[model samples]
Target: MSGETVITRFAPSPTGRLHLGHAASAIRAHDYARERGGRFVLRIEDIDGTRSRPEFVAGILEDLAWLGLRWDLLVFQSERLAKYQAALETLKARGLVYPCFCTRAEIAASASAPQGDAAPVYPGICRDLTVEEVTARAHLAHCWRLDMAKAVAITGALAWHDAIAGAVVADPLAQGDVVLARKDAPASYHLAVTLDDAAQGVTDVVRGVDLFAATDVHRVLQALLGLPVPSYHHHPLVVDAAGRRLAKRDGALSLAEMREGGEDGATLAARVRGGDRLATSW
Candidate 1:
């Protein structure tokens, strides 16, 4: 991701209201790029149709603007299905993708796996399936999974310079096989994000440390798609007084709730900047 100017993005899923954590990310992305005379790209990660709301998206934009954090023309992940599909086809042609027909119960039966914020580690039961066999099984309900074995064979010991995490190595074993597409969403986070970052010519990625592990999966996909590798910065996550990471379920810490109690822009800004040192950290 070499360029005369740097480009960064704050891709937020509009599943809930913009809270302190959201403000921190938006401010950091906006300020970092602006500080270096670069571009700040805004991408709405609304692939999850069940939870993504238009009202929430609008409110997010409103909150960011209220904080005086402006971004470039907005891009929505929901609008880029064909691009993701084409990339999926490329992976398939390279024999780096297969269909997995495992239900929640069946996958659970493999092991009582440890959670990493998202679902448990997906067992590679179907990772070695042949394309024809996978195709036949695809007729039934199943999502597409990336063949990490083939992917790692193509790119060995992948590593990148993280702006904050220093040298980051891509761990193939921990990442294992990942889903590219699901029944509900057209594209998974791995596929959609990798395509969007490349398309936007992003020079660096700045997000919470929560996503540090996923970078390995993205790196492998980047190699498979022949896209440029951008520098990453996994900053500290914003946690509450209880030390729990802020989430959508933490409605009490929302900007809207604080605003309802007579907080203005400057007040919100101070709290956000002070709450987690969030602006500069992310």
Candidate 2:
């Protein structure tokens, strides 16, 4: 890690159009860095080749620029596959990665089940699977899962200095064995995010409060990979009239639709900030 001035990034996946929720994150990240006399970065998370679209990326850049949000450097994750692979290999060599052959149905048939709002906790059926057994059982190229036990042993407790929430700790047992690389996807969100954040030398991470739960997984991965954990600030999410989170799927609330409705950047920014106008300087 640089261990220097603060550096924050606004990373948006180009799978859908930017909405009010996205604007809140972008604005907050930009403001946080600027307030600290630090640098802000723009990263395009276009790893999902199937859903990611060039048009969406273009729109995101245009929207942020309209809001007067700027960054020091712009990056695309699609161009960093080799970096992810190298990290994956390092884990593999250390026996920190295991091949999981459990199909979705098989995982669901396990004795226990996932809790509310969380993806089914991986059963860890493959954690102890031997190298020969794992290779033999696999029909197709299987995914590589993190060895949580080994990881935790290597790094006792995963902790981070958060910006808003203060100190944070993660339990590897709760996170279980997270996927690192998949047959279909090169790198999972947990893997890609940790690697990218460390690589970019990010000092702070700002996002919606809804992601607070997942922060544990990110923290655990950072410790396992010997990466620096950035301070986090999970801000409140913007909601619609119905008190539901605004999302890209809701076309009417999307930035594109708002633009067509004659809402300028200043107006949209005001609406997001509780219908009150920001300083003209913002």
Candidate 3:
């Protein structure tokens, strides 16, 4: 919309091989940048260190290369812990983020209703903890969750523009107090992505529609951190013949498997763009 040099990125977590769904998203981002003579970036979202394997990271790079996808810049989130920590501290100083020690079971038990497709909305269990109480739990394992209500009050009304969906208002409340830093990881996806997008100077974010809702939380983070908000374009997700969304755990046909079964990289990319359903066997 701004006619500025667009910067798009294909960020994938290296926990498994690239599947057809991943290919579609990558191709969309790459083409968006290429169409405008802009820069395309590749970011490895390996923040989940325990599950993020080096072999998977290597496989991701190889898969993208095989697909003829080129990136102007490459970054790994594992290497940017300090930056994320700094951003978290900035929020903490603003009294916008609080610690939450709730486990999965505890949260599910406390939630009043189902929270849109994902885990139930966090019910702000620890949002009003006293300083002494917070100090007492400092040594225990905990996560930093954004104080959604406080955040909204500070930022007031907010909105962002999307290419397909048009202008959208920010609704951080629906997401509840999203975790900024997890007990197991230095930063959560919402926090890392918002910071990384700003750090990379990305002008346009192109990805699947599944993440369209998550944009609300990201917008709040951008406003709280005083970071530039980028235009978003959430495309449709690739689904199997059964209409089930593709996922790594569902034994979806991976790019590596397709290549081994004699699929050409460029041809496969074209088929993906054309919305040709992939065979489960191949």
For lDDT, the strongest prediction is: 3
Residue 254, candidate 1: Cα error in Å is 1.8
For model 2, how does the per-residue alpha-carbon lDDT over 1-282 read when each residue is reduced to its tens digit? 464788889999998878777888898898888998999999999988788999999999988887778899899999999999999998988988888878877777783855664567788887887768876887866899988778878878767666677777665678778898977778988889889989999988988898786788787777767788788888877776666677645432677766777778876666555644232211
**Each model's C-alpha lDDT?**
0.81, 0.80, 0.90
- Listed in order, each prediction's TM-score against the native is 0.91, 0.89, 0.96
Please identify model 2 stretches exceeding 4 Å from their true place.
1-3, 250-252, 274-282
**lDDT over C-alpha atoms for residue 117 of model 2:** 45
Error of 2 at 37 (Å): 1.9
1-282 in candidate 3: lDDT tens per residue?
Answer: 566888999999988899988988999999999999999999999999788999999999989988889999999999899999999999999888999988999999887877665799888888899989999988989999999899999889989988999999978798889999999999999999999999998999999898998999999999888899999999988887667788766668889988999989998888777777655632
Could you tell me the lDDT of residue 27 within candidate 2?
85
How are the candidates ranked when ordered by TM-score, highest leading?
Answer: 3, 1, 2
All candidates in order of lDDT, best leading: 3, 1, 2
lDDT of 1 by residue, 84-158 (tens): 889888888887788888887777778566665566678888777776887788678888888787789888888
Number of colliding residue pairs in each model: 0, 0, 0
Q: Kindly give the stretch of ten consecutive residues in candidate 3 with the minimal lDDT sum.
A: 273-282
Among residues 3 or more apart in sequence or in different chains, the pairs in candidate 2 whose N, CA or C atoms overlap within 3 Å are none
